[model samples]
Every structure is written in C-alpha cells, then in structure tokens.
Target: MAKTIFITGASKGFGRIWAEAFLKRGDRVVATARNTETLKDLVKQYGSTVLALALDVNDRAQCFAAIKKAKEHFGTIDVVINNAGYGLFGSIEETSEKEARDQIETNVFGLLWVTQAALPVMRAQGHGHIVQISSVLGMVTLPVLGLYNASKWAVEGLSETLAAEVKDFGIKVSLVEPNGFSTDWAGPSSLHTQPLDAYNKVKSDFQAGLTDDIFGIPEATTDAILKLVDSANPPLRLFLGKMALPWVTQVYSDRLATWGEWKEVAEKAHGK
Candidate 1:
C-alpha cells in the first residue's frame, strides 16, 4: 500500500532524496520548504502525487496550515519526517545571542510546532509515524558545533518523550541519527560565528578529525529510510552511518564509567 508522507525541508539534501524515493515508490508526498520554488522539479516529475507547500517551520501558524492542507489533500498522513534544521558552527563563547536564539527557534521550536500540528490528525487516524532527522551530535558533541549539538540534544529528548506519550495513539516516533553526510548542511544550509582566537586550535583539531570516508553518500540513505517508514515495528532510534554505533557506544561507556566512579559521591550527596 502506498503511504502519504509529510516531510519538512524537502528542497535539498536528505529531504529531497527521501521525498524523491517515496514518490518513485508510488507514495503521496506533501513536501514543505521555506522556498517552494525549489520543489518545482519534484512536482513536475511526480505531478499530483506531490503537493509542494511553502513553509518556514519556525512559524507555528504556517506549520498548522501546512498540516491541515496535507491532511485535506491526502486524506491521511502516514508518516512525517521533520528534516528542517541547520547547523550553527561556533564555540559556546563565540556564539552571539541572536545566533543561538535563531538556532533554537528554527531547529527546536520549529520541529515542535510541526509535530504538534500533526498530532491531532494522526491521533484521529489511529496510526502514524514521526521521524525526526537528528544527528550523531545529538548523542555526543563536537568542539565547534555547540549550538547545533544542543539543538539535536533537545530534539532527542523531545522525540523520546513524544514516542512514549503517543504510543497509545498508535503513533510511532523514531529519531534518525545520521553522522556526517555529503549534504550541504555544512555548506549553504549552515551559519558560522566569528571565530574566537582562543578556540582556533579547538576548531582546527575538530576539522582534522573529519575524513572523507566519515561522510556517507546521501542517496544511499533512501533505502534505509524507506524500510524504516515501512516497518511494522520501527526503532526508537536508528543510526544511519557506519560510525554512529561505535562512536555512540564509546561515549556511553565512558559516561557509565564516570557515573560508576562517582557512585559513592552521588549516593552520599543524597544523604538519607
């Protein structure tokens, strides 16, 4: 059966790839982007199967309007991929107030608005899947990506809670945590703060850690996403690169070790 998918940020990168994949497989797509003009090619290719809408996810009213239009167009929304977010590359001290606030508003609050708008429609239908496009940074951190990491962490927590809360409504929530991909996330889609001389070495060292192989092919993710959307029992978290599991495993192991090492101190602080 063909499913109806409502996805944000469908103009480029993984969003465009996944939307094309779904349309190729005969699914209905309600694609939203800040610039709907960028989505013209998809509409031309897929015709009526694609409903391209202009949406700035940061706008709550637009989010609701888009959802309403999608529900009315497709009758039911089987899946939603919240893929609209950008990377804010900057050290904590280097980030400006406006930059940080904009990051949170678009990445965190934007996702929340779209998710909130879809809930009632999904609840009424009794089955829906919400896939949040988080990043490996959501679980760990990078030196120059403090704000970006914080946004994904917020998404991680929000989506986890959403999964637990919406299970009774037959809504499945999954976080697709991808490592570095050959997306323009670091290019046209991103913003960089003015560098602080103190953090120059930190930024350089972080950049040194990245290699060509660490970046996955964006198109290759289409199959994994398709399978995820089609699954009867989807995972709460799905890592989309070879490096995600190993990297996250080490981080958790170190965290557990630290907690265990501090167990006595932690218990003493409780002081029953």
Candidate 2:
C-alpha cells in the first residue's frame, strides 16, 4: 500500500534521498526542513506527491504543528522518519554547554516532540511506524563525537521504551543505526568546535571518514531505509551498514565481559 510518510531534515543527506525514493514509488511524502525553499526543486519534480514544509526540529511547537499539518493533508501519517539531527564534533571536555544542549534539543527532545505529536494520531488510526535515525555511535563512543554519541544513546533508550509502550496500540518504533554514511551528515550538516590539539592527532586516525579521501566517503543507505519501513515486523533496532554490526558487536562483547567479571557483585543486589 502507498504510505503517507513524513520525513524531517528532508533538505539533504539520508532524509532527502529517502524522500525522493518514496516519492518515486508513488508514496505521499511530507518533506520538511528548516528551509522549505531547498525543497522547491523536489516538489517540482515530484509534483503533488510531495508536500515540502518548513520545520525547525529544535522548536517543540513547530514539530507539533508540522505533524498536525501532515495529518490534515494526508489524513494520517503511516510512517514518520525522524531524520532531523546533526553531529556535534568535539571531546566532552571541549564541548560547550550550548553546543551540547543544541545537540540534545534536535537529536533527543526534537524526536520526543515529534513522537508525542504523532502518537495520538497513530493511536486513533491503530497503526503507524516511528523511525528514528540514530547512529552506531549510539551504541559505541568515539573520541570526538562525544555529544553526538550522547544524543544518539538517549534516542536508543527512549525509543526502546517507546516501542514497548506503543506495541499494544499497534504503533511500532524502530531505531535505525547506520554507520557513517556518504551523506553530508559529517560535512555541511554537522557542527564542530575548534579542536583541542590533544585530540587532533588521535582523532584524525579514528575519523578518517571526515576527510576527502576515497575510504572517507560513506556508502549509500537508502535501500536499507526502504527495507526497514517495508517490513510488517521490523526489528526494534536495525543496523544499516555492513560495519555497523562489527562495531556494535565489539561494544556489546566488552560489556558482557565486564558484566560477567562482576556477576557475583551484581547478584548481591538481588533479594536473598
């Protein structure tokens, strides 16, 4: 069935690609960005199938209004892709309070606001999909993307709780954790602080994807998004890239090791 899909951050990157793909398949897409003007070309190309709207995810009220507008236009939103977030590149110590707050606003609170606004409609409709555009960084931390990691980790936690809470209502939540993609997410779409020299040499080694070299470019992930939303029973967490599982598995393996090492201490917390 053709779906009424609402996508945030539709101006560029994964969001834009997914919007175009959905439109190509004859699905109705409510494409939103801070500047709707960027989508003029998309609307022209897709015709009436695309509804480009101005949306600043940091603004809670604007999120509700956009969802409301989508519901009014398409009757009900069958899918919502919360792809509106940017990376904050800096060490935790070097990151500014304002920068950290801004990251959380868009990556965490912004998603929450959109979900809150859309939940009522889904409950009424009895079925809907909430897709969160998180990152593998959500599961594993890196040197420079501390704030970004924190924001995505929060998304994972809240999204898991949301999935359980809404399952009874027939509403589903999916956390899509794609590794660094070839998207502008690390380029123009991202924000960064003046780097501390202490992090420069080491961070350069880990963040090769930040450069213009061949291995630095991210691969296309639009097909992964298609597969995710098309499934009737999608996973609560879906890793989109080949490297995603390897990276996440390492993190989990270390966690399990630490837990096993402290198993006796952990068991002491349980009632005798």
- Give each model's whole-structure lDDT: 0.96, 0.88
Pairs with steric clashes in candidate 2: 182-218
Give a tens-digit lDDT track for model 2, residues 1-272.
89999999988888888899899998999999999999999989989888998999888899999999999988989999999999988888788889989999989999999999999999999999999989888999877888899999999999999999999999999999887666777778889887788878777887664544322233266677788889999999998767778878988999999999999998998969
| Candidate 2 wrongly placed segments (more than 4 Å) | 208-219, 269-271
- Candidate 1 residue spans exceeding 4 A from truth: none
Name the lDDT value of residue 40 in candidate 2. Answer: 99
Q: How far is candidate 1 from the true structure (C-alpha RMSD, Å)?
A: 0.7
RMSD of each: 0.7, 2.1
Candidate 1: lDDT over CA atoms?
A: 0.96
Model 1 agreement with the true structure over 28-55: per-residue lDDT tens digits = 9999999999999999999999999999
TM-score of 2: 0.94
Model 2, global lDDT: 0.88
By summed lDDT, the worst window of 10 consecutive residues in model 1 runs over 202-211
